[model samples]
Target: MNWDRLQEKLSILSDAAKYDVSCSSSGSKRTNKGGLGNASFSGICHTYTPDGRCVSLLKILLTNHCIYDCLYCVSRKSNAEVKRTAFSVGEVVSLTMNFYRRNYIEGLFLSSGVMKSPDYTMERLTKIAKKLREEERFHGYIHLKTIPGASPELIHEAGLYADRLSVNIELPTQKGLELLAPDKNHKEMVKPMDEIKQGIVQYKDDKKNKLVKSMKFAPAGQSSQMIIGATQESDLDIVKTATALYKKFDLKRVYYSGYVPVLSDEKLPALNTSVPLVRENRLYQTDWLMRFYEFEPYEIVNADFPNLDLEIDPKLAWALRNREHFPVDVNTADYHMILRIPGIGVRGAKKIIVARRYGRLTYEKLRKLGIAMNRAKYFIHCGKYYVSNDYDSLQLRNLILHSGKSKYTKQFDGQLSLF
Candidate 1:
């Protein structure tokens, strides 16, 4: 193999793949049955696992050459500044084996630009994964970014080998796609998503009915990504789209990538404009609320408030908006109501439920249980001990902000006070 040429491709393709944040290896239980590697259910890429161990994946694109001229994409065909490159199937297989042997990565995350066509591109991706699994006996995790217009047969074949498959929605709304990415549409994207979803369901049903003994079709399940701040879609629009996709597709995750404004275009954001990192973070927090905290999309963002409050989290914003729900009685409130209290998470709510059974939970006991008392005190009350005064929402907001800052100031002063 040409080492110098392969290194150049690695530099270009790996850098190109950095924009994709949907490449997680979690939820896969592909064991190493006399293979090169194992994909544990706890493993995730560039993120902490449930057991607090951080794992890595060899994330790279199959190629950067494309046919479409997307205004938001750096790898668009019109972009002459980006150095284009491609990797053969064998080279990708070789690279995965080499990286795994050296302990550089626990798994592989492979995505690609549309080289010639979607099927043409997806075929190469599937081949690389097939070679890794069948020929090389590599049981490591593999995440393939499914092309939108790829044939369903190819997509089904890809799922049989890949641990997780993701189809990037790219933009949040159809209007954004029409403006920046004219060639793409939501229909084409949703097709592959539906196919992957059905495949996952069918596999589970077949396994349960004892119709199939050894069949794995994307065992980690499929996820998708949407780019934020590229167009005029409001946070409400994005959240609604995400909620629909999650319900319709049964997705494992819906990743949000804040627009970086890498390329200059008439339709895209200005290159100098700040990336919407806070908005993206807030959206992820809202997503967690919907998925884990049982928050409905309307409850988080609706016609009254279309966007998230960047200053505070979604749960706190919700509590502050509906002041009638505040000052929940920790000792008497149900699990779901206790979950809605600001600064109290799922674990804390569970602990309160268990602790209150033995005895009433006081403010001090709640603080001892690792609840953020500074924020929770205003929203919760124990028996005969009201922690919050009759302050309005606006006043409560200011007080909370001030108290947080004051705590930080006191900590800083104690470390550096000259007196």
Candidate 2:
């Protein structure tokens, strides 16, 4: 193995892997028992160095060589401009071990473009993961990106070694998949996710029944990703699909990657098209409201309003649209009602519930409990502070939007806060 050629391959493959957004290492409880490393439940690759260098996961692809040509993808097999390379299983193992030892990365986030057959590529990926676990005794988090049409047997074997697994849904709708990625099938993608979910369930049942000493099958659970803004699919379409995936497959996370125009195909957006980062951010906020805040997909977006308001977060947008639910009495409101308030988070809502038991909360006291008073003040009434002016919905929305703008201005001006 030539070290120089390996480094060249690493640079190309790592850059190619950045398009994948489903690599978060959260909810994995793989502990190091006389092993090289441990998988923390909190997450990995989320830390910053003293010089502000991010020492996160070593995210890379096993190969950039592909047989199928997806129009939206930069590493599509037909793209002659892209530098192609593939990493042997041994090279990946050596790199992962070395990176862990040097403390450059806390874990591995491995993906690949299709090389030869799906099963052929998957078998190699599984071997790298197996070597990391059994041969190397490396306990650091391993997140493998499973191929869509890979056999169920290889997927099950992958779960035995990987802490987490992901299968990229690629696009929001089946129509989008058919248009952009003719080589991919929506049903094929969901098949692996379903198998992985069942494997996780089976492992738990085995452990409970004492059928196995330690039933390990992706303890962290599975996740998937969707490329946003590629097709004309609405935010409603995206979130609705995500909601179904969570309900049907019991997925941990649904990552949304803003479509960055890389390949200039007539079927795709122009190469100069700006990345819709803010739209992606709004989708994530909408996702959080659904997962943590108990928000339905329809509540965030509907047939009339199929997209989220780009100006504000989804929680605030929902509150604005449904003003009749507003002005909730913070002191007397239930936990769910308090959570529905614009500025109050899960932690803040719990705090309000506990604090109200002792005494009624004022705006000042609410601020101390981590509420974003600027936004919440419009929707919540507590203590002696009653909203004097009954502003219309448009007026109230402008007030909140301006408040957000001002807060960001102050932050840029170096107005720092302790909490």
Give all candidates' CA lDDT scores. 0.86, 0.85
Model 1, C-alpha of 90: deviation from truth (Å): 1.1
What does each candidate score in C-alpha RMSD?
A: 5.2, 5.3
Candidate number of the best lDDT: 1
- List model 2 lDDT by residue over 70-145, tens digit each: 8888889899999888999999999999999999888899999889999999999999999999999999999999
TM-scores of the models, in the given order? 0.93, 0.93
Model 1 bad stretches (over 4 Å): 46-55, 266-272, 404-419
Could you tell me the TM-score of candidate 1? 0.93
lDDT of 1 by residue, 47-108 (tens): 33222334488888999999998887889999989999999999999998998898888889
Clashes of each: 0, 1
Worst ten-residue run, lDDT, model 2? Answer: 404-413
